[model samples]
Target: MESEKYNADLSRFHGMIENLPCGFFIAQAQKPYRLLYANDEMLRLFDCRDLRDFCRYIEQDVRNIVAVNDRERVEREIGHDLQAKSDRFEHVRSHLFTRESRIRYADISGRLVGTEEFGPVFYCTLQEIDIPQPGQMVDRDIRDYVVGHLDEAIANQWIQVYYQPVIRTLTGELCGMEALARWVDPHVGFLSPAAFIPVLEQVRLIYRLDSFVLEEACRIMRQRMDEGLPITPVSVNLSRYDFDLMDVCQVLEQTRQKYSLPRDFLHVEITESALAQDSAVMHQTIDRLREEGYEVWLDDFGSGYSSLNILKDYNIDLIKLDMGFLRTFTDASRSIVTAVITMAKELGIKTLAEGVETKEHADFLASIGCGRQQGYFYGKPQPIGGTLAHIESEGRGIEPRKWCHYYDVASMFIRQTDRACALFDRYGDGHVHCLYANKTYGEQVHELGYQLQDIEEDLGRPETAEVVRTFWAYVDRSRKSGQMETYFYIDGGDYVNTALQVVCEMNQHLLIYVEIQNLSQSNAGRRQSKLDENLRYLYTMFEDVYLVHI
Candidate 1:
C-alpha cells in the first residue's frame, strides 16, 4: 500500500508540471546551458520533439530570428556585461517566435529570485509582446515627414521603380521582372513600402500610386521596345485594397494602344489573400485580363491558405512562390513542393520563385521543375538605371550557375527538390503550439515549426496547436505507450498522413517524429503513386507548394 501510494504521488507531481498551461522553465545562470526542467507548454512553444535534443537549439535565440545587427550587440552584452554584473536583474526585449512563423516581441526578464530555502537559482519568464503596425521601424514622425514634401518629391521623380528580375529556369532566359514601388521623400528619404503603403491604403490613395507606376511602366516598356532592347513582360503588383478601383484589363488595354505595345508585354500580379476573399470578382477581372490577351500571375503563391482545391479552382497563368518556403527543408515541405510543381505542369502554368539567395537554392528550384527564380542570387532589386547598368556591365545573356546537391532533403519524393539548401534556425519559441488533435482514438503531444501553421492552413490539415489542455488527459494513460502511425481526417475529407516516429530536439522544444506515409489521398492504389497524387493535389491547392528532400 505504501509503495503504491509513493508511486502515485510521484506520478502526480510530474503530471502537474507536465500539464502546466504556461511555458515554464527552470534554469541556472549557466552559459548556453541545458534546460533543467521544461513544462508541456514550453515544449509546444519551441515545437521541440523531445528534451534530449537540446543541443540542436539555443536559449538566447540570437540567431537570424533576432535580426542580424541586433544579435551581435545582444551577444556582446551577454558576454561582456553579464560577467561583471552579479545578482543583478535585467530586462531584455527582443523578438521571439510566437508558435507562428512570425517573429513577435518577447520580454525576457531575469532576476535572482532565490532564497536559502530555494537554493541558488535564477527565475525568469519570457512573455510574448504584441507587435504594433509599421513593425516598429518608425519611432518618430511617420506621416508628417513624408506629407511635408509631397509635391517637391513627386515632381522631382523621387518615386522610383525597383525591378525584381524574374528568370526562366529551363532556358535560363529573362522571362520578366516584377515592379516594386519605392519612394524617397525629401524629408524621409528611402522609406519602406510598409510605412507608406498603410498610409496610402488608409487614406485610399493607393490607386493613385498604382496608376502612376502602371503609366510609368508602360512608357518605359514602349521606350525599351522602340530602342530595340530585349524586353519581356513586366509585372506590376497591385493591392486588393485598392486594385479593384480600376479595371485592370481596361487599364492595360488603353496602355497597350497608347504605347503601341501588345497586351503580352504587361502582366498584372495579385496577392493570394486578395484573390481568396474576392475570388468571384477576381475571376471576372482575371478573365477580362486573360481575354484581353494578357497574363495573370498569382503573386505570393503559397503565402496563405494554399490548398489543392484552391489551385484546381483557379486558372492563374504564373506562380510566384513566396520566399519563406526556402527557410528550411523538411520531408513534408519537399513532398508538397514536388506536388505543387507537378500540379502546375498538369495545368500548363508557369512558376517562379522569389528571394533566391544562393546558387544552391537557385539550382534546387530549377531541379523541382521550376524554371524561373527571382531574388538576390540572380540579382538584387534595383532602379531602371541600375538595371540597365547591370545588364550592360554584366553582359546581356543568361548567367551560368552550378547546381548544388542537398543530402539533408528527403530523397523519397518522386519529384525531388533540385536546389541548394540553406541552414535555418529550426529552434524558436514561435514554432511552439499545443494542438488539441484528439481524434476518436487517444491523444499525444506535438510541437511543429513556426511556419507549420501556414502549412496546416495550406494543406487544410489539423491545427497542431496543443493548448486546449485536451491532449494531456490521455498522457496519463498513454505516456508509456506503443508508437504507431495514425491518420486523421483534416478539413472536410482531407486526410493528414502522420506516422509515429521520434522527434529529436534540444530540451528547447518537442521533436516531432513523423514518417512519410502519404498525404490527402484516402489510402488508395500504390503507396508511391498515392504519395505523388496527394502531393500534386496539395500543390494544386497551394500555388507555390514546393518539395524539399526535408
Candidate 2:
C-alpha cells in the first residue's frame, strides 16, 4: 500500500547540499555509475571532482564496504536479498583522510528509493556518532533533569509494599512477615529492585528506598491490625549497599518515628552468608538494631560454614536456611535435614527451613523434630490481605520426616571410594587448572584432580566422570614435573581460592593446600569496611579440590 507522498520546497534540500561540510553525491548503477551530480563541497572535500581518482581519494563501493573475497558473489547480492550475508558493512577500504574526518564512530543509515530520474537510488547518510560531548548536559532542561529528586507525593502514590509471612512451624503461626517493595514508574510500569536498587545505591538513594519500604510495610501492618488481623511482627531485608552511607539502625529508628511503629513488631532478617560476610559490620549493625528493639534473624543458616558459627558468636535472634536445601528435599535429603536441624538446636538458634514444596517434604521435616517451616507447601508468597493466613491445626510440629538419605552421609565423612586426605589441598598450573578438594578434606585423605573448565564449573559441585579424566592429567603433571603452587575451592560446594602445593607423597604432602580468601569478593568489600572476618570458607578450600585419578 502506497501512502500519499508530500513534497517540500526543492531549495530546502539544495541549500543543505551546498552548505554541508561533507561531500554528497548522486550516482547511477549504469557502467561506472557515472556521477550524476557532485556539489562544490564534494570536490573540495575529496580534493578531486573526477570520480575515477584513487590514491588520495578512496571510492566507496557498496560491495567493498562489506569484506568478502568473492566480489562477484557480493555483487550478486546487491538487490533486496542479503540472506547469504552475515557480517556488518564496514568501510572496507578508506583513505587516511577518510578516517581523520570522524571523531568516534561514523553513524550510517541506508535506504533504497526509486526516483523518477534515476529509477533506483540507494540513499546512504553519515553522521558523526561520538561520545557525549563534554558540555552535553550544559542545556538547562538536561541539567535540571540530572539533579532532580522525586517529590514525596508523587513517590508515595506510586510505591507499593507487599509481605511474605514468616511462619512458626510449632503452632503454624504467622510469627512475622518480611516486607517486599514494588515501584510503579509512571513511564516504565512496574520496576523491580534489581532494576533500580543499583542505580539508587550508586546515587546514594538506597537509604531513602529502604525507609520507604519499611514505612509502607508498617503502615500496611497497622491497617491489617485494625481489620482484626494479627500479623504483628514483620521482617525487612536490606542490602549491604544501603548501609554504606549511614548506620541502618539510625535509619530504622527514623523510620519507626516517622511511621510511629512498635519496636518489637518489626524484625530485620540478615542473610547468614551476609553475617559470615563481615563480622564487624554485622555485629555492629545487629547490636544497634537489637538495641533499638528490633529482633535480628540470621537468614540462610547453612549457606556458609562461618555463618553457622554466627549463632554462637553474634547476638542473633533467628536462623533461616538458604533455599538451595529445598532442591535436596528428596528422601535422599534425610541426613542433611537432621544434621542441620540438630546443629541449630544445639546452638539454641531457631532454624526456619525455607522453600517447602510438598506435603511429604513438610512431613519428613516435621518428623525430624523440625518445628519451623516456610515454603510453597504452606502457601505461596502473596500480597498481604490484611494479615498472614496460614494452614494450621493443633498438631505436633516436630516429627521425623520420611527422609530417605541417611543422616550420617550428609553430615559426616564416609570413606566409600578410597582413603582420602582429611586435610584439604589445592594444586594447579596458573593457566592449566587441575584442582583437588573435598568437603571431608582434612577429615579424609585422597588425591583428587580436575581441569580448568571442569574446575570452574564444579566450583561448589561434587566430583563427576569428567573430573576423573582430568584428575589423571594432574597426576601426570605432579609425578613428572614435581611440586607446584595453586589456588582451589575446598568444599561446602563453593570454591574458596586457596593455595595448595602438590607434595609427591606416596602418602600426604605437607602444607600442600593453603586457603587464601582475598576478602574483596566476600561481604566485606560490599560493606566497604575492614574487620577480622572468618568465612568458614569451606568452598574456599574444602569443596573445590584437584584430584588425580590413576
Candidate 3:
C-alpha cells in the first residue's frame, strides 16, 4: 500500500513538471551526460518531433544541447559558478543548438541533485532569449556578445594589431611604434575600441585582450627581425584591470622570452588615468618592468587630473602628451604644452606629442624640445604588413645609430641645469657641431658679443678658431686620459672658464659636454671658485671628475 502511494505521488510530480511554462530537464553530471528526463516544454524548446527525436538530436547527451562554439566556455563558467557557491546551483547565459541546426540565445539555470539511479544530475530550466539588434544593443547586449565571441574573434584573426610610428622629433626618424588593437567583428562589422573595450573591462575580460595584443606584438617583432628588417621598440597598451586580473610582469616577461627578443624591443604603456588610481600593484608593476629593462611610458598624459602627482610618484620613462592639446591649437594651448614638455624634460622624462596632423604642429613640438612624435602627419596606424611596406618605401626603417644615445644623455644633463651648457659633436671631418644649446647657453653666447647662430653655423670661423682648437685639445686629452679636463682661455678679452668632458666616443664620433662660464671682469679667486663649483657639480652628477694641471 505504501509503495503504491509513493508511485502515485511521483507520477503527479512528473505531470506537473511536464505542464510547466518553461523548459525543464534532468541530465547526468558526468561526461557523456546521459539525459534522464525532459519535460514536454523542453522538447518543444529544442523543436523536437517527440521524446525519441529529442534524444537523437542531442545524442542523449546534455552537453550537446549547447552550441559547439559555446560549449567549452559555458561548461567552464558553470563549473566555476557551481564551485564558488555552496548551494550547488548555477545560472549561465549561452547559445543553444536546436534540432533544426538553429542557434538560440538562452538563459539556463540548473541545480545539482543526487538520486539513487544517477549518482549526480543537473535539474535545469532553460528559456530562449532575443538578442537585440546591433543598432538597439545596450551595454548588457554588447557585454554578452563580447564575452561570448572574444575567444572566437581571437582565433579567427578578427582582432588585428596596428602600428603607429613614433618619430624622433629632431631627426624625424622612426624611433618606435605603438601597437593598437582594432577589431573587425564578422557579426557586427568594425568595432572601435570605444565600442568594445569598456565592455570587456566591465566584464573583466580585458586582460585576455591585452595579453593577445602582447603576443601579437612579440610575433610581429620576431617576424621583422627574421626578415632582416630594422625594428624599433613596439609599445603595447595595458589596461588597469590587467594588474588586478593577472601577473602582468610575468606575462610580459614570458612573452618577451618566448620570442627570444631583447627587453628593449618591447615597451609597455599604461594610461595616465590608470596610474592615477595609485595602487600598490601599479607601483610594483612599474618598478618591476623598468627593472627588467623595459621602458614604461605613461600614455595619454594630462588626460587625468593627477598628471603631476603621477609623475611625482611613479618612475615613468616617457610621457605621451594628450591629443587634446593639438585638437584645439591655441596660444594658451601651445603655452600649456610647452610648459609640460619643459617640465618633463627637466624631470628626466622624455615626451612625445600625439595627434600631430599639421606640419605646423610638428614644427612647434620640435621647437619645444619634444623628443618624439606620433600623429597622422607622420603615419596613421596600419597593420604589420602595411607598416613594413610604408617604412620600406619611406626608407625610415633603419634603427637609430648608437651615437644617438650620447646626444640623448648629454641633452638630459643640459636640460636639467640652469647654467650655460652645450653638447658638441666632432666627426672625422674635424668640424665641431654644436648639436644642442639650452636657452642659458644661447644667452651666454649673446653676452659674449657673438650671435648664437654664428657660433652654431660655423664653429670653425676664424674669430672662434683659436678657442675651438683649445676646446678640442682639452676634449682629446679627456678622451685619451679617460678623465674630465678644464681650460681657461681669453676670447675678445673676456676671461672664459670652460670645462670639457667627453660624454661618449665611438670611433671618429666624439660627444663632448661644454660648460662655459664667462668670468670676464672677475678676479683670479672668483674664477678658481667658479671652476671648483663646476667640477664639484659634475662630480656629483656623474661621479667622474678630475682637474688636470696643464
Candidate that scores best on lDDT: 3
**Index of the highest-TM-score prediction:** 3
Residue 242's C-alpha lDDT in candidate 1?
54
Tens digit of lDDT per residue, candidate 3, span 1-550?
A: 2222332344423323545677777778898788777777777767787777888887778888887756755765575457556436555666665676444567788878766755777878887666436454233355677788999999999998999888876556787889999876655544557557988999899999999999999998898789987778898999999999999999999999999998878878999989999999999989999998888999989987999999999999989996578657889898899888889877888788887766788777765677778876676678977876776677774445464465455445444356688777777666667767777778878888887667755655434576666666787799888777777765665567788788787767777878887875445636577664665567458834444666
Kindly report the root-mean-square deviation of model 2 from the true structure over all alpha carbons. 23.3
**Per-prediction TM-score, please?**
0.49, 0.42, 0.61
Provide the lDDT at 457 for model 1.
43
Q: Over the stretch 1-550, how does candidate 2's per-residue lDDT look in tens digits?
A: 0000111222322222344454444444445443344444444433353434422243434322322323432333232122212222222111112222321222333344456755654444333332335533212222122224334423656656766555554335455556766554443233334435556656666667677777778777677657765445677877666566667887788877766767877878766666765647767778878787777887767777786467667887666765466565555466776677777666555556776655666666654545456664555445776324333332323212121111111112212222222222222322222223333343322223433344434532434454334444554455566654333333433333343333433212211322344334446434733321333332245644344436
Name the Cα RMSD for model 3: 21.0
Clashing pairs in 3: none
User: Can you rank all candidates by TM-score, best first?
Assistant: 3, 1, 2
> For residues 350-465, what per-residue lDDT tens digits would candidate 1 score against the true structure?
77778676666776675565656887656656787676566556455533222111111211111342211111112244343322111211111122222434533432322444
Off by over 4 Å in 3: 1-141, 392-397, 401-404, 410-422, 428-434, 437-465, 476-501, 506-508, 513-550
Instruction: Report the poorest 10 consecutive residues by lDDT, candidate 3.
Output: 1-10
Model 1 TM: 0.49
lDDT, each prediction: 0.53, 0.47, 0.75
